[model samples]
Target chain A: MTVDSRSEKTRPDRAAATRDRILDAAERLFAERGVLAVSNRQIGEAAGQGNNSVVGYHFGGRSELVLAILRRHAVAVEQLRTDLLTRVHPGSALHDWVGCLVRPLPAHLAELGDQSWHARFLAQASNEPTLRAVIRADAKASPSLRRAQEGMFRLLPAVPAEVRAERGEMSRLVVVHMCAEYERALQNGVAPPSRTWETAAARLVDAVVGLWLAPVTPAVLGPDAALRCRR
Target chain B: MTVDSRSEKTRPDRAAATRDRILDAAERLFAERGVLAVSNRQIGEAAGQGNNSVVGYHFGGRSELVLAILRRHAVAVEQLRTDLLTRVHPGSALHDWVGCLVRPLPAHLAELGDQSWHARFLAQASNEPTLRAVIRADAKASPSLRRAQEGMFRLLPAVPAEVRAERGEMSRLVVVHMCAEYERALQNGVAPPSRTWETAAARLVDAVVGLWLAPVTPAVLGPDAALRCRR
Candidate 1:
């Protein structure tokens, strides 16, 4: 091959590797600290990039950088969700569908092993307003996630739509924060409550099922009745 | 009184006001941004302190500042908890005990009116390692909180202690993050899932009661059986 062709052939590969390094560094820093806490300069230094502006050059801005990190993990997690979805059928119980929603991320983290930072990074991202919208939009784009959500909701016909939406948010918070806590525990050399991610996820699935199945109390509006509502 | 005596008396009042300003500014910034994401310099500026060292001068470090803000809100929340606990008796139902655990913060926030940031601030603090420890220790110190916890656990006689602990964490995560989300939604001019904090707390109490009552699935260890466990 010509020298120009040889250089051209390696260019994309080199660029991909550089992008991966930056994403890894950014994810770790964002997870360890906070999403808005860490800066591009620190990310560049952690990634071993000579140019401080390399992050900006590659990712454009903070939201784009966060989206890139999320998309990187989402591909693997999305595949896990799809795999789980195949096992779920029309006759599946609520727990099975909930597993489709809950297990993918933990299962993905399990595959990533001890070095994974995706859970913590996503947990931090979920707290930031702008990044939260980004995550919601991204999750909405995932057909597998939507399917799992729909399947879980299908089993809860007795639940009001508004209550389901609220419980959905609760389930997301529990799963995301709990997984992040588990990851943090492992990294800190602290013994997590569960022996394995599998066990933790199982426990989470149980609590979430309970959360979804909980009875809703109707709101009683008015000042005089507000005091008596607690009883 | 003489001019000197009057000036001396006002000095202490002025110092208290300054500290309150710093605490208010720090809490809002930490809530809007992440805890570690914000700097003392930013906090001081937000507080309208001309000197950059004002935050450090008032509060020795970041943890101290966070603790100060927490303690400021805790006094009010603790009082609300105590008041709620008075209404909860040994004969009270599971929901009553759960209400004791869940309602105080939301009640306190409700009293704080539309401008409250404690929920979001505490939510952010709960995510940070050192701050999470600080929060746990603080909560453990509250007599009313311990009483409420014991009351709730008493009703769940069948749940394994490990599972109880796990659910307890889940309850805390759900309450903290859900309240935070509500606060954020209110601030963003969006309609929250629940019409009022009172109703939100009611929903949380219901879910937490269900969570504590969830059936535990036994963990089956071993690589060969692991894949089959999900099925």
Candidate 2:
């Protein structure tokens, strides 16, 4: 398969290969360092193109490259998340819906075959306005995303739309933090704190689902619930 | 009062002033543009230093400078968060605790005046590893941070140590997102989507608090409670 090309003057296949190599290197380097710390020249070197202009020529600049990395990974993640949600049996329970939400990451990361640098990349990416906007725009158009949305709405039918939106947003933030924790663990030379990605995924899914499953009356929510739940 | 000095130069006062001026300009630029997009020379010029050496002289480099900005604001935020939490009447309700968490941003942002740039600076700062590490380490030693830890612990007494840690991290992420939303709104040359800052703060606070306060069941309190709680 050919990668898309816009900035390079080469054979279509060569241009595509060069572009993919640049993005691959850029994503990994950005995760290891950061978007700001890595440079166009470094990305070019890592991709083996031997041309500093490749990043600018193909992606226009670092910002645009970041946008490209974001869009590319978002498509992959978006599809995986969608596929998992769609595979849910027609009448899955909230717990099953929760499973569908959390279970896919490890599996997908495994499939990524060490190219899963995007997990760390995402921790930083979620904070970038340009990248976040691209991801959000694509998500808004995703049918699978709509299905996930319906899954949440179905799970929290009693909750108001505003509440649902808030919950959904919080859930997304929790995932971001979880990935950061995982990234941090990996960086520290610690085996993933999560035994199997599934276990870690389970914890995240359950914690979030527990947050919304609601028996919490406004008055008795905080320490009481936390302590009570722990005990 | 003098700002912090450069480690290299013996001119503590001049170095400190230059450092503060650099920080001032950096914070402003970060808020107006973003950490990823701005550069050291621009920061130097805006500070009226007219020298590229300022980045290396005062803060070691761009990344450290970002850390300085984060450390500076994190100190102030921790203090305000602490002060707000302490005055909680002996028997404040959960909502009161939630309020303690949310109300200070706008209040402190106002007090910050020119330094209000610190909020958006922090929003982007969370993504920078060197900066994130510095702020996190510094936060661990900050006295004002105690109230947040204890307050959240009080609020979620039933949660285990690990879960509490996760919740605390999530709470911080929520704050970052709130800061980002405000930054984005301003970036687009519009006021925040909420009718008022207070209204936005209230909704965001409620959403965060609501997640932690979710109800605990016998299932949640079982031998597998910790495991189940992840859901």
Candidate 3:
């Protein structure tokens, strides 16, 4: 009765807080165990919810739950990219824009400090067809990401659409899996090849920039390739 | 008495055949579902074994089962890599040596024709930390892979060890994930980015070669990287 008289706006903030707690617990468990292995009941318990079904109630299912986690990070990651965009000049080198693409992730993870699992969680999701779609769709919504991509592409040679798409996929694989491996390595007391997250990001930036700058070789189109996309 | 003699000699062959059937079913199911989602009983039934426990009886558990699947493919892929090495002279270009590393995979998949699950199975395994170790250990055992690594390394710039290791990981992620995507795409009637298997392999080779050739950025080694190796 007293709550009914209070501001309804405060309720939304409480709901948001509950949502954050569920996502946090879900990401950590999913990262430590396999994604499919951890159940929503476990997530609810970890989130300190009394009801075991709270994760499902709040997020619907695993896919939505996963998306919520991706989205929670996407906003912050996009913000980092947006902040970095302010430093970019019109004629910056390809590597500079590339840095804009790669740096935001590690920088954000560093901000998360020791308890980071987003990168590992993401890497695990990348291998699953459905989960990977959620990530791709979320990434496609980033205005700053699209800007960095266009800026980088403008500096490179006009690659065939197929090659362009292929490289883009490669870029994703490298970033997610490398970070996953590095994060896992640090957690296991096995030293990561690159010392700091900053240096790891640096190495990743250099390799990715190189990937973009590499020349494309004309493939001898077999019947299938020719049928799919004739030059 | 005659039946006893025949059963003893043929028992080994029958067990071998059952192992092959189990591997085939396990790979197919694992590729279609996920590594953790499928059960040993389902695998046994799929393999046509009447005994529900035959999968566990034959292969021990999921890790061993996954390893058996990997080992089955490793020999043929390694053989192809070995065959390719004859053409790689000491002065071969970095791209040529890179071919030795990348081509064997798609080439082997093409050999399997329409029904191949190795790539997808590998992609799924890559998500699970334990399963991935089995794949990595199997790859490590191949003499040709070692030779290819050494050969590729010789043609490239002397990158810092951490950077070199980092890029090597990047190379693996791009190869496995892209091939997995391509395989799944082909299976589902979704046109792959590069149409044919050969063309897809060609694009991958070109990109990885570029990655290896990318200039190494000097790392600002934090204490961990510095301790691992000094410049």
TM-score on alpha carbons, each prediction: 0.95, 0.76, 0.90
Choose the strongest candidate by DockQ: 1
TM-score: model 1 vs. ground truth: 0.95
**A129 Cα displacement, candidate 3 (Å):** 1.3
Candidate with top lDDT is: 1
Evaluated on CA atoms against the true complex, candidate 3 attains a DockQ of 0.45
Mark the 10 consecutive residues where model 2 chain A has the least summed lDDT: A222-231
**TM-scores of the candidates, chain A only:** 0.94, 0.76, 0.88
Candidates' DockQ values?
Answer: 0.61, 0.14, 0.45
- Which candidate model has the greater DockQ, 1 or 2? 1
lDDT of 1 by residue, A134-160 (tens): 988999999999999889888875776
Fraction of true inter-chain Cα contacts (below 8 Å) kept per model?
A: 0.53, 0.15, 0.53
lDDT to native, each model: 0.85, 0.64, 0.82
List runs of model 1 lying over 4 Å from the truth: A1-3, A192-194, A225-231, B1-3, B192-194
Interface RMSD of each: 2.0, 9.9, 6.1
* Per-residue lDDT of B200 in model 1: 77
Give the lowest summed-lDDT range of ten residues in model 2 chain B. Answer: B216-225
Instruction: For candidate 2, give the docking quality class from DockQ.
Output: incorrect
Candidate 1 per-residue lDDT, tens place, B1-231, comes to: 457888889999999999999999989998988899888899889989999988899899888888899889888888888888889888899889999999888888877877988899988888898998888888999998999998887887677667777788889999999899888787777965447878778888889888887777787466744574344
Top candidate when judged by TM-score against the true structure: 1
